[model samples]
Target: MSTTRSTRPPRTLVHPGPSPLSQRWRAGRVLPLVAGLVALVTACPLLFVALEATQSGWDSAERLLGRPLIVTLLWHTVSLAAVVGLATLVLGFGAAWLIERTDLPAKRTWTVLAAMPLAVPEFVHGYCWVSLFPTVQGFWGAALVMTSSLYPLVFLPVAAVLRRSDASTEEVARSLGHGRAAVLWRVTLPQARPALAGGALLVTLYLLGEYGAFAMLRYTTFATAIYTQFETAFDTASASLLALVLVALALLVLLLEGRTARRGGRVVREGSTARPGRPLPLGGWTRPALAAMAALVGTALGVPVYALGYWLVRGSSTTLPSASIWALTATTLGYALTAAAVATAAAVPVALYAWRRDTRLARALERTAYLTRALPGIAVALAVVFFAIRYAQPLYQQPPLLVVGYAVLFFPLALTAVRSSLAQVPHGVEDVARSLGTAPLSVLRRVTLPLILPGLGAAFAMVALTASTELTATLLLAPTGTDTLATQFWTYTTGLAWGAAAPYAAVMTALSVPAVLLLTRRTLGGTRIPREATR
Candidate 1:
């Protein structure tokens, strides 16, 4: 007789203590409500988009969407996303392979450098390229800047997966007479398919709503057009229509990403006996491989630094009062820190709700928060403005209002970080704590939060990093007279004062480094090295 083994992962039972109904209710009630509320808050942007678009009649939408410029911009958006998406996957995957799987020189140093581009803001990347080579100001230029800045999104995930994944499958294939190349194509890539699909989705959705990079590169995408319509033309009807188009494009990307992920072959991750793939010796390929890695880092990270240095040296305005710069830096830090705290705190309830209960509603609520992530910064900013003006007039243009916007805009990111952390927690640890006559709140405070400290740290750092660099939203939602480094940088750049912008850019890059380091350490720590492999 054959015994059947279930493929499903074990369900984390939340039913602990008293009656099943009481336990389920105790586990869920407040958590579900809190998570649902968070989900609803995140959906504010989508709500605003829908309502604003409705303000335009079918005729207005027809005229707006029918415009040749609109059509061209849509095509521009799709094409750029495709190019950048493909380029990032190839570069990201190749770089991950070089750093994680190949016997590259100074692997640790290379790993940090590979993830360094993420420290540079997207707009800063564009500014660096455009300021240095003014000729780099079109589709290709935009692609180059975007690919450089965003490739880390793909690289980090792929590298993390590669670092942790078992090499036994590849070894078995190799022993079956398959070459290294075949094993990689068949075994390794399949394992990383989910990560690749997720990364592609992020890159594509970001392009759909991106304004800063394309704007700086002089590339007209739908996101930029929407910004121009809203900010420049002050035409809500037209802007809303364009935003709807962007949302549609984002949905299409989501659908495609889901489909790609679904079509992927099953990933095989065996238990603890599994071992990491050993680094393959490069042999004669070492020099060429080194050259390739150098070129990538040089273009992606080196150019930005060189450009900033050149501007600092040449710009007569580089001496812009240190007091002023410091004040702006302080202001930026304050806002970023506050937003990070708020976003992370808000995420806990949502993440906890999903963790405690695996119901459909809980899952849907968690997913709802992610939808706003696909929106452009401008769209999210506008949504905040729309709601703040209508519902909470006092919050309009207030400091707290901007914090709310940041929380809403980056909620999904925070949720992901927190949830991932919570997922790693030993199953029923919280329940076991509660079973010991501890109250739910105490168990959460003492047991749950401690277990997910790393995740919380990662979430806080990531939110702070992104919030500090955020431009489009800050420009719109900032209270009157508040100045951030991003806004100052944008101001100087727009005025052709690259010299003045250099300091802000430099400082912003510096601020991001610690956060990047923390995230890398906490979120994607190095996998354990086997004794034999190390020898």
Candidate 2:
């Protein structure tokens, strides 16, 4: 709406117009462009693998595809994904219900302990379990390791929804003479459908690209098979063939997840604080339940911590190649920091555009960011390799290309964090800035940026931690001699040199300690915010 002031010579009122193309151009473009470029580059390796696989004709594809080993690998991969998805869903839903619904003892403590599994990388956990019990080295071992590592993904999201979900509907159902079980199944679980599906999707995708745990546990899934084909057979074609198959599987999981998640509408927390649902009394099972929780925590957290410590102690006495270890650590940190900065910078506009613009284009771009997350690291690395060799041969083996791959692979972490943080800023603040005759850029710099800085930092740190531990892609695309901690740890662990692998794993876990602390602080701070502000 606009008004003309007749007494003031018909003063013109201005309406916000689309930003000019030139104004859209900023150093910010470098981030997404770099991200896009890395995505393309990572796409290359997979492309090469695919080309190699298909170029030999249908005969070769059929021969490779028909092998008993391939069939078993496919079975293992799918089974692991399915089982892990179910496991994570159960853990996520049950934990969320217990913590957010029931009168769980020390709810806050449980919350932190539950989510803390995410801090430990799957590979590290695998190493710990295998070290503790040599028998933990096969399909069952893989499932156990993955369940412990990935249940947190489901737990985090479902917990969030459960915490903020409206309880009135469930109460209403209860008032209608529905039994407790009926009310929960009919009302509560349905409300958590989207979050559960999303979490399951994440778990499935992770299982698809998994290498470390699979390798450590003697489970030869697609990821390990691809690596084996590449390394043992010296046949990138076979690996690419396998990778193509893996990509198809990932895509299928992703699509199914999307449908499941989209079935539920957005959950809204209405009115004032909703009472957390009462925890069902454990009755005589209290001690047993506590023991079960203890066992779960022990397998997931305790074994890993103890094993890493044991190996560190053992490795300390052994002759460690200090120069190599130090160099690898420095390289890992450097790449992580670079990727974090790039990812965080790239996530800003994508998030801001989604938050403020509300256009189809912005929405699509935000979704694109999520696409990379859903894709397996191997697929992304493969694509990057193909793109690099074809277009940027000079970048064929450069560290920059490697860093770019990291950013593309993990940008979603930054995007999600930034989006949540940006959502916290009230639109009224932006309106106030605009009313005060401030430009969009000024408002962004003065108002939005300051408010979201913590979020941006948190995003950067999260990405940094993830990038540092990324194994499969880093193994495939890292420069000829660059040894990341993940790759180093994998090499030693695979060689059955537990003592040597321990140092790298310990250092990696040790490096993540600060990040875990920061995340805990953030979690507590977010939870402690006024209930209204949380809304």
Candidate 3:
């Protein structure tokens, strides 16, 4: 009995090459460090907010938070966010569906017009409405203006998603005897869930942080309360408490979005060669639908344009000094350009880390970067003021500080655009370059950078436009005697100097036009990253 022959060959203990965990670890070694640094920089204002609140003492904060006014502010803020969010969602979704899924006349033109409201800031919209009708004030007025301004945020993304969605599920539902409306409600809308949620999140965050429009409408929301606390009462403690409450509200919305967003409906076998379904016939409903679109476009776009044109024509004859206008224009352009460049640059590392390295640390950093956008610009400015006064005295009241404030407030805009663009760049290209001995930095510079330039450009334009329109932060952090178009416009508008304010408003709107066109075109043209990368 050859027992030795029955013995199995010695098992070779072949070690695995590299586990997925080790590969991920090696790939992301530098990303976390860079992301952490960027997150810290973005979160600096938030840190200062916490520090300022702490320095004021917990007892003082509790006292401030306990006030009746604080409760009222909370109510107003929450109510406004809810109302505006719903309004924008309905309007955006309806408009997007009509244009994308129905035989809507002038669909291309309608799409562009629908998204143009984003060009007009909420404050500008408020001003136009108030000028036309002085009684437009309080909650309803604020909600109307905000809904109009922010609805475009929802429309753009929703429309883009609708455009790209495979229509197989919708057709299948129709073939199963479901009506067009039923198919839309049960199938199409579900597929657009992610876009709807994203757009709704933006609207909610905008409402939470809104100051100028609410203030102009005489609505006493948390942001307006915080502004008043700082401006009229010179009470930093009360303001910080209010800001903390606002931040909590924003975090609540973010949490809700995170929980719901993951349930987004995705198409099965999206790579299938199924053609998009034809637009459903509007038939008898065409005229009414067209009328509705007309009214929406008129309210959101026409009135503002008419008002600005009317004012510009009326103000052209006024003998106000041209030097101040030119100077303010120059200052606004310079500051906006600087802020856009800096913020876009700062967003690159964060976007790269979040997209390339899908880890908890990377996601946390990305979330931290967006926190500032959820806060009032005044809160961010005050934090910067506190930090500058206490630690970096020399930086206080400097142009650099003002730019830093803009960067903090607008960095998320750049991050969104850059991240979307980065997602489109194929990972295999970078991996192949790496395999061929190209350094990571060189690959980014040579391959990745060129591929994402359009996105970066869009980001720059978006940030620059927003920074130019920024009111509260600019008012707070701007150097003494520094006057941008926004500040000068605010100065005149507050004094009922309509003739004086008109020019600055016109100039500001003019400056925003190019950027707005760039952004609207990019969004409407569907500059989305591949689904695989985003997931």
lDDT by residue for model 1 (1-535), tens = 9999879888878865575446546756778777788889889998888888888889988887787997788788888888999999999989988887889999777778888998999999999999889999898999999999888878877787677677778788989999989988998898777778878877786677678888889999877878888888888778877777777776677667767766654443323555776788999999999999999999999999999899889874644433388999999999999999999999999888877778888877876776687677888998898888888999998999899888888887788788877766766787677667776777788999998887788789889998998999999999998889999998888877888789899999999999877655532465321110100
Number of backbone collisions per candidate = 0, 21, 0
Off by over 4 Å in 3: 1-28, 267-274, 316-323, 529-535
Residue-wise C-alpha lDDT for candidate 2, range 331-359, written one tens digit per residue: 99999999999988877777776676666
lDDT, candidate 2, residue 19?
Answer: 54
- For model 2, the stretches where C-alpha displacement exceeds 4 angstroms are 1-59, 66-69, 269-285, 314-327, 355-364, 374-379, 422-437, 479-481, 520-535
Give the Cα error of residue 478 in candidate 1, in Å: 1.3
lDDT of each: 0.81, 0.74, 0.81
Global lDDT of model 2: 0.74
Candidate 1 Cα lDDT to native: 0.81
How much does candidate 2 score in TM-score?
0.82
Candidate 1 positional error at 321, Å: 10
TM-score of each: 0.91, 0.82, 0.91
Candidate 3 lDDT tens digits, 1-535: 5556467888889975765445545656876677688789788878877766787887887787788877787888888889988999899999989997899999878987888887777888888888778898998988888888889888887776777778777888998999977887888888777777778888888888888888778888888887888899988777777777777887787777776667778743323454567999999999999999999999999988888887777763334343478888889989999999999998888888887778787888888777778789988898878778988999998999999999988988899888878876777877887777666677789988998899899889989999999999999999998888888788767766666677777778888888867766765674543322121
